[model samples]
Target: MATAAGFEGTLAALPEAKRELARLMLAARQPVPAHPAPRSGAGPVPPTALQARLWRRERTHPAVATGSHALRLTGPLDTRRLRDALTGVLRRHEALRTRLTGSTAGRPLLEVDEEPVLRFTEADLSGFTPQAAAARTALQITESASTVLDLESGRTSAFRLLRTAPDEHVLILASHLAVFDGWSSGVFLADLAAGYREGTGHLPPPELQFPDYAAWQHRWLDGPDGSAELACRRAVFASDPRARRAAGGFERGHLPVRLARGPVARGLELGAAEGATPFMTLLAALGVVLARREGRTAVVIGTPAAGRFAGALEGAVGQFTTVVPIRLDLTGGPTFRELLHRTRAAVADALGHQRLPVDVLFSDGTPPPYDVLFALHNYPAVPLDLPGIEVGQLPGPPARHLELYSPDPAAALACVGLVERDGEIGGTAEYNRHAAAPEDVRGLLTGIEEVLDRAHTAPASPLTPRH
Candidate 1:
């Protein structure tokens, strides 16, 4: 395995670029802007290229899908108040009330239904005697999310309640990716609580909506500054053989993996770099293993940078997700420790230019920058406790959620996703069954963890694969 056994000699043998990157990562700062993106029009705005792309894919793959937050609430629940809260949220966020329409003009448009009516269907499934309602809820989450949403009537979201016990029930809030995202889930829960507690239609005013962001994005990209940024980003990523091999090599499927979490936690706690995040450290480990497996001196991995970089859109619900491709240079034969520092620098640079739309990055499929997508899937798990009921949000990517919500299939990615498990961090890898095998994905996962464990112990180790 790669080791940092060499002291001064190894550090002295690094390339100029890598050495500079190491210096930068060691001193990088977490930049958080005080203001949010400005909003303009409140009326119907054009759908984002991402939304349009998803809408087209949904037309063909209607069975593959989004997410269902199946919450089991015990004790008493005010069904009327819950409904009112949800309706109020729908009224506030135009995304929930917006529909994708192509007939409006040559291009697609978001048709907003200001006073759209939504109701939750309740059923007493307590008849499944001796059978656990939680079991039923788990099985139905996939089916519930897979059903194609009717955008024509703006049925982008759905809610169903199954009575499991006199004091226990499952509240499933299913949504399509077109109108929702990882962050949006938390927004839904928070809004629901405010509605139920303060009463519906009584919340504060929402600053912006999905359409406003879309309009802003289009204007930015089409403008001179955006055009220059897009050109530069596109120029950086040429092409690679790894992307081809990943798409056409192995049998693809989901491999749900849970690694021992102590390494990540410890790594973060003991990290010498103050500004570098634990997630970045984890990603750097992932990049090392991937670079080794592919036998490529340079590795490219795509990851999603949330669209909520601006504070204003933080509360607005929409598909505000952006894809960021992180390219790691493993040349100059640097140690794994050096690699981590280098990876951190690369990520920071990418984030600086993340505002450049994903459309420009992968607009044309000719030169696929990356076949692997690595990300820390930090979906917020907000909890709610009302008098007698307790609520929780389920983490996703058991294949069903990723299969339905994963943004473009054109890249044909071998996704490596890290998630929090019982306080420690673990990983979940997924790929199309037609492209990769379960065992293959598992092997990759194991190798990645091995690399991570070793790095956590001593990040300066040489870049040698463990036997």
Candidate 2:
């Protein structure tokens, strides 16, 4: 436990290069130019059938479109076979070749082509090292979408083919969060596998294409008579002064620092079947840690929720996520277990309040003084497969950076991003470099882990100190 405490200090003391990385990521978060005549309202705009038919319209930020082709034949890989398969995969996902342009209204727009922007390459894998090939492959999977500044969007997805010492071949598919949601990963993998099999002639038919989902989305978002839910959401939004804030206006700049990535130092998980949903468990854990660190009875953390909770927008998959600020107050009234109950209630209330765009929520003469932001991604359960190969699903990692500042005028602030994948829950803490030592950051995560483990069994005991 004492050693775990030291781990926190180590994180706080990450090298300057790590800090620069954090800064770059932070800069990436600045607001982009607003779209001209952007959809008005807290709710997302509905796309028309014509809009849905366009590949660019369906592609969204936080999800990248990438392509990869691999050959694992009985003999030497047929470059011809690999190239053909790659072309087919690229064609299937039109977004791969799509580009974005700013509308006259300043809104972001998408453009698609039957051909791709970057041409495909077939490297000599038999001679090249795997790591070298992986890195090379990462570079070739170019961006179909970019920010207004022309900086590559901070998202990534990939198609990789590996020859396991001859005779055997494997394809690995992955995408970063910027262009794809966790839910969509499964959909993509499964389809890629099906598509690959069909391309290779092993499968009888390709399952439903993405167009099916787009068609469904257009029908649902557009009112039965042909109008879109956009007008309704817009009406509600226009009436609410808070709805007009900039979409990505949370913070101006970041200081990127890579803490030493060691074994989780400490972590735990809540089973999916426990009837205790992840949201509730996560909130409870967050509340306990923040309360202990700040020595305050209550702490507020911002959570991102899909604002498109209405069934009407189920098929609409743009950037519909909203930020919800949850306050956990543990003043003298309740014990850990009791406070957890309060935490659950607070989370529920905040979800309902999520209708307000963060721009509005923070727009008052004053910004809400919350120091931490935690988002839960319980992506729906789905199957995943890549062409000729089966892809295994693992709980995806959460955002590594936590931008922390004291929400209180009197206190300094620290941020921690807590995420759970598969059943394991762990967090990365971000503290003000000026106010926090590398050791202190490590201590925070260590303390949280101890609190969680001990709390699960001994919920009544005071949290044990690690460092």
Candidate 3:
């Protein structure tokens, strides 16, 4: 609905660093013409760009594209109600019932089974000792999480209930990442709890489904709008020479880091003074560290953006995430406060044009623009309250096979993920051992922490030589 003149006026108000990128996006923006409604009966619909990429990678490395969530329930649980809830969730989300049909050699299509049945496996470990039961439950959950889903057969979801005691049970839900994501995990739990409290019959069906999204995405990308968007993205990266370099090979290693509440609070305060969010603040700190470590004036980092900008897509669960490359310019030895403003503008510009699929940016075997990935997991917390049962969340199974099946296998030299819990920030830094040593990776994390401290304590201190 935005006119080109109005849009240009808005971009003109952004920071100087953000102007060019925003202008390119403005050029790509066009009035969306009315299109036919998405195909209803899903015989075989085209997959979203991200889904198709995952499907291809999955074929080469089976069993590696899986995601799972686990919950521990205390107090008596009614078996009938639990079954109904599980069935209701499966019936509600079509992505769980979808399968990839056709040969891998050609473009794959999605097929949804109208009346899919949910058949979850159950285990009773109450007979064993408490510790033994816990160990056995973990083993079972890991096995289930590692199981390769049969995409062609629509066997993409696995649910397991392990009863350690008559009143205690653990529910583990696993599904292919091709059809699921972090946001979907929260949706699944919320829907399940709702269905358990109020019978599934009372719940209204979602206005849209994942298949509808896929169909729409296909049409949009094949049209003039998609072409303009792609061109805009390509121009943004083409202007940056650093973004053209290839990523290093993969050799995964992890290091855990935690920041106390004091520094985190101060950092937040400093960022707020500059009109920046926590993500932008932390990203500025990261930029400082990378600039200092590599001794460069500029750096590019990749971050994931949730593509569920539409209201209808919010409740519909599916893989709707895209990796957006954020480029930072730190040439003038800017203070932490200055850097924060620059980062804020850059992130805003990138996210404004996130609808363009990242895969299309590098279709000719060119590596992803960034070698380091950053993610802040701020997913909505869905609380599950059954009538008399107390539900507690347990850490989900680890993604051990991510290295083999990751769509962007060579795109990341190191990846950093941060999550806030109990007033403290904790995260893991995963690095490619082939490219960086453990000690160096440790030092990089340490540097990030130090930069964060400096940002709060002396916001005006320059990160590099002012001259």
Specify the highest-TM-score model's number: 3
Alpha-carbon error at 451 in model 1, in Å?
1.8
TM-scores for candidates 1 onward, in order: 0.84, 0.53, 0.87
Instruction: Give me the runs in candidate 2 sitting further than 4 Å from their true place.
Output: 1-99, 105-119, 129-178, 199-275, 306-320, 352-360, 363-368, 375-377, 380-424, 427-437, 453-467
Residue 41 in candidate 2, Cα distance off native in Å: 20
lDDT of 3: 0.75
| Model 3: lowest-lDDT 10 consecutive positions | 27-36
- Superposed by TM-score, candidate 3 places the C-alpha of residue 60 at a distance from the truth, in angstroms, of 2.8
Q: Write the per-residue lDDT of candidate 1 for residues 162-187, one digit (tens) a residue.
A: 77778777777778777788788788
Candidate rank order under lDDT: 3, 1, 2
- Candidate 3 per-residue lDDT, tens place, 1-467, comes to 98867876887698754664454343235344333234433445777777777677667767767777788999989878999998888889888889887734486778788876786888899999999999998887777777887677788888899999989999988888778887888888889889999989855657778887777676677678778888878887775544323245565677776766677678878888889998898888788777776667888778877777676777877877777888899988888889888999999998886666677665767676666777778888888878899999887555532242234655556777788887778877776776667777666566767787877777777778311
Q: Residues 78-109, candidate 2, lDDT per residue (tens digit)?
A: 44555555455555553233334444455443
- Model 2, poorest ten-residue lDDT window? 34-43
157: Cα error in model 2, Å: 7.1
In model 1, where do residues sit more than 4 Å from their true spots?
1-42, 63-65, 103-105, 132-135, 239-242, 245-252, 262-275, 393-413, 456-458, 464-467
lDDT of each: 0.67, 0.42, 0.75
